[model samples]
Target: MTDNEALASASNSAIAAAVARLAEASASGVPRPPVRDLIGRDDLAAAYAVQAALTERRLAAGARTTGRKIGLTSEAVQRQLGVDQPDFGVLFDDMAHTDGATVPAGSVLQPRVEAEVAFVLRAGLADGPLDTEQVRDAVGYGVAALEICGSRIADWDISLADTVADNASAGAYVLGTDRRTLAETEPADVVMSMSVNGTEVSTGTGAACLGDPLAAVAWLARTARAFGEPLRAGDVVLSGALGPMHPVSPGDTVTATLSGFGSVTVRFGTGEAA
Candidate 1:
């Protein structure tokens, strides 16, 4: 075989190995080691390949695609990963929870909570220029949201590729009922406060998310189209976390308040969230 063929074979092997490790963690509810050792930290393409394969398996298993999630929008995580941009993951239908709902047991491992803004799209992003203006026009409405982040990597000792290959460490999410227009309340100016069991633990503003949640959505739209999976109407986009994420245990209740956008709450329950 030629050198190029050999290299491709090795890459395919690595992607498969990483997928198996992550899939086992997801199914068995046991955290695995970081996948960067298999896919490497800088090979983002290979990392996303693993994610795509995992997403395929879930779809084949009857999991319905809900939307997509943006991750690593925070500068701290970017610095940690040595990257300038962000990454994304697919959100399955089973990963959604309504406001004041419970998160089913084993839905995630090493779970943490962060507040964000959720946008439901009314227009397709595939044919647009993918800018803040285009995203503004595409957005149906904005609502306060909480992204329940969980890591399959034990202790969350993850590199960029590790998290990317692990589907951006996505868990479940809860969205608020109150919706606002981009004209009514600009996302970049929104303030966020997150509390765990009545004690405030994290705080931030919309600017923390790639300068603005709308900007983040624009970035995701551009990236997703580049990857051949563009954002479409009715998609629920989680525009990354606005603040530090706090850990949660069973029976812990998380509540996040978005200034001028009301709040969303979720409970960590012993049984299934449904």
Candidate 2:
């Protein structure tokens, strides 16, 4: 075979291996070697390919796609990841929880929590450029949300490609009961405070999420469209974290409150049947 063919073969192998590792980690709740090590570092396209492949595998395995989650939209998170832009991942039906739900700690490895604004889209978004207003108009309502992020990479040691390939380090999410349309409230002015065990730990505003949470959602819609996956009606989009993320442990109760949007709570418990 020619050099080009050999390179393509090797790349395909890496993607397949990475997908297997992610599945193994998710099932076993164990960290795996970073995909950046298997594929070359800085190969985000390859990493996304791996993410898409694994997501498809998940869909085939009976997991239904619910929506998408945006990550690294905050400057702080981007700085931590050493990236200038944000990344995203698919959200499945099994990964969703309602407010006051109990999440099994054993189901995820190295889990953390971040407060966010979630949008329930009222209309399907086409594959193309979308502005913040268009995104806002498409939203049926917004809710206070907490993204439970987990990493399959050992000790959360990950590069851009590593996290991107690991389904954007997504675990599960909890959504608040109360919801409001954009006309009823300002998405950019909402303030979020996250508390663990009844003690406040992190705080931020909607502006922390790429200036406005709607903007992040717009970016996600456009980005997904570019990837051949358009945002559909009824899809819940978890706009990136409003501030820094905090670690959570079993028996811990985490709550996130958004100004004017009410609050959502999640309780963690020790190993339970998946």
Candidate 3:
């Protein structure tokens, strides 16, 4: 087979195996093996295929499709990875959490914390050229969210493509109680700051997310369409993080403060005893 054909075959095999793994994880309550190991090709195409298959299974099981998430939206992250833009992932009902709730650290592998903005989609958006105002109109409200990320990989060292296939290392999110109308909040005009252990660890501005976080959401909606799954209504799309990712350990409290949307805080469980 030619290279393209070989890749296609490999992707097909990976997708099937991924679906099986998903079933196994769900049944046994164990984390699935890192996609990098399960699939020989740790690329975005393979990852998206796995995501699509998993999404199909979730929909079949009566799970509600809420929205999408944009990862690596920070310019610092992009520069670190040598990429100019962000990646996307799907979000289901089970992946959400309410603010002021404590998240058990045991639920994820290699968990970390990130501060972000979330857009609740009021209208359907698909592939097309989208401007900032158009994106703002599509969003009904915005919330302060703390993204908890976990890696299936036993070890954290991985490439961008590998990370993408690992579902953008998404674990869960805590949505703040405070919600603001999009018309009132211009994503670019706000600043983001994160503190860990009562000390400021990182800081960034909303403009870090492609000039405007709403624009990031717009890019995600279009990108989802290009990937064959268009964004839909009632989706709470995470517009990406405004600051650097802070690694979390047991007994650590992570807090992200947005200029106007309020803040989200999560306390992690203690780490394994040495």
Candidate 4:
């Protein structure tokens, strides 16, 4: 290999080690510095790969791989982050909360909420130039989703590299009960509403997700495939959120309702709001 390739490999391995340490610290409730503090370079893909490796390690250690989440899908968010598209992260079984479920705050750090659409994958999607229709066909069903994100890095001041190494800030998620089959609905045009403590917070459409949630998924699939890690069947895909993310605290009740997908509620207890 060339010198640059060797250096890149070393850098990727180092970043992956750091991420693994961070994940262990988070899971064990140990003290640590912000992720940004440790990110010494601007290689976004390597950093993201490290984050994915951390999640993969967790999965190997018995954390069930339940789903995947898309982040930075909105134009505004992308502009703010200086990214042209969205990022993806893994979701664990322990992080999946049912509708109306109450969770302790200690499980997550600086939890934030975003309303989104969830797709249950029916088959595997390999690396390629995937069209929107192919993404829709790969999707088995759609449901309302709430992505509960948390940052391991202090102050939540992170660049794309730092965020990538932090697993795209995916912490927890809640899913709506209503599941619509792909053939029965239009995933792109659905409307959604999010509220906190019974107060309406935001309104948006699925189109906000790179024109449609499936499109976002397709983008993620392509990206992952490029990295030699294609998505497979039974993986739940969380399309990017529709509106601004809402920070949450203990005692907060968040409800994200979709026009045809119904609603999902998450109640944060003092322990679950970490």
Candidate 5:
């Protein structure tokens, strides 16, 4: 066997092992140790391979791919995670929720919430220049969004690869109803404020998301295409957090207001929020 091909086979084996470890954690509701020991701590390719394997398994089991989510767009978050570049993860249909929906507890392990702008695409990103302009043109509208992130790695002790393998640490998402076209709402200029039970906890502007939310989407489009799976029409892309993500407890109400895009709120099911 060729040297490169043989090494790839070994890598694939390692990725599969990592995927199984994470899946067990998710199924058992017990976070496991970092999978980085299997897939090198910085081996993003192998980590993504684990992600793909898990995604395929889910798809085979009838779980539908709804969209994609970008992570680490905030410079502060990037610094906190010690990564300069961002990562992407696939979103499943089951992870989506509407405004005012109550997310029950125990569904997400180690839940943390962050506010973002979500774009619903009007065109496919398969054959485009994958630039900011093309990304903006492809968007049907933007809405306020809240991403409830979770980790399968114990205590969230994860490297970049570990989180990537855990589907960018995605948990659930909530979208607002007041949507507006790109011309109607300038995402980069919008301000964000997130409160829990009427107390403000996080605040930021759309520009905090990789300078502009559109730029983040453009990056995701290019990255996904390079990975040989470009985004499709009608996909909902969750732009990375505009600020820091805050953890929640049972019965906490999370309400995020995106100035131009309106607000999105999610209630923890009586005692369910992390």
Candidate 6:
């Protein structure tokens, strides 16, 4: 192999090994050292390569791809993560849950929840710049979704590369039953409120997510295509969070209610932390 190819292969192997270590940490419910710390560099390209390798490993192990998730869309989240733009991650079939489901707290490390809107696509979208209307038209319906985010990095100390390498810190997601077409409602105006045990914790609007949730979906379509993976039909894309993420623990019952769309609830089981 050429020198450039040899260097690329070495980097890929290093990233793959880091991904495997993180997977072990996830399985054992323990947070591992950040990949940046282990590799001594913060390269976004290398981080994405690690994410792709881990995703391929999951797929090879029989986990089916369900869709994609957009993260760091809200200004608040961006500020929190110290990033200027958003990131994308792949979602698998097993990561999806219906409304009112109980999530095993042990399955995730440093679990948190965010309220979001989910787009169920009816047609495949190709790579290219797309308008909001185009993105809206491709969606079969939109539903209330609660994204369960977890970080395998110790104490959630993560940079952009760290989180990206960890699949955008994606854990699991739950979607509400209420579905509506874009024509039925104004997605930009939809408001969402999240509560834990009957007490409100966070509130935000659809505009908080990249100005409009549909715009975030459009961005995902374009970005995924640029990465050589276009969004497919039947995919459920989780538009980024409308508000700040709320921490959850065992016995916590979190509910997110969206205007026009129904509410979704997830109860955490009594699994001890690692």
Candidate 5's residue-wise lDDT over 1-274, tens digit each?
A: 2222233433666877898999999899999999988888887777777888888889999999989999999987777667778999999999999999988877899889999999999999988589999999999999999999999999878789889989999999999999999999899998999999999999999999999999999999999998878999999999999998888887899999999999999988755234
lDDT of 4 by residue, 165-250 (tens): 78888888888889999777787888888999999877788888898888899888887776666888898888898877878888
Query: By TM-score, is 2 or 3 better?
Result: 2
1-274: candidate 3 lDDT, tens digit per residue:
2222244435566657765765565555466655556555446666666666666777899987677889889987666545565788777777787776666657766777778888888887873565666777778899888888776654555556555655666778888878999667777887988999889987888988887898898788777776657777788888888888778887888888998899888877664553
lDDT of 2: 0.87
lDDT tens readout by residue for model 1, 1-274 = 2222233323778888999999999888999998878778767788788888888899999999889999989775566446667889999999999999988776889989889999999998998589999999999999999999999999988887888888988999999999988879989999999999999998889999999989999999998997889999999999988888889998999999999788999999877444
**Root-mean-square deviation of every model:** 3.3, 3.2, 4.1, 3.4, 2.8, 3.1
TM-score of every candidate relative to the true structure: 0.93, 0.93, 0.84, 0.88, 0.94, 0.92
lDDT of each: 0.87, 0.87, 0.74, 0.78, 0.90, 0.86
Backbone clash tally (model 1):
0
Q: List the residue pairs that clash in candidate 1.
A: none
Clash count for each candidate, listed in order shown:
0, 0, 2, 10, 1, 0
Which stretches of candidate 3 lie above 4 Å from their native place? 1-9, 18-42, 60-62, 79-84, 270-274
Residue 13 lDDT, candidate 4, scale 0-100? 49
**Local lDDT at 259 for model 5:** 93
Instruction: Evaluate model 5: give its lDDT.
Output: 0.90
Residue 271, model 5: Cα distance from true site in angstroms: 5.2
**lDDT accuracy of residue 62 in candidate 4:** 88
Q: Total backbone clashes of model 3?
A: 2
List where candidate 4 sits over 4 angstroms from the true fold. Answer: 1-17, 28-33, 79-84, 272-274
- The window of 10 residues in a row where model 1 has the poorest summed lDDT is 1-10
On lDDT, the stronger of 2 and 3 is 2
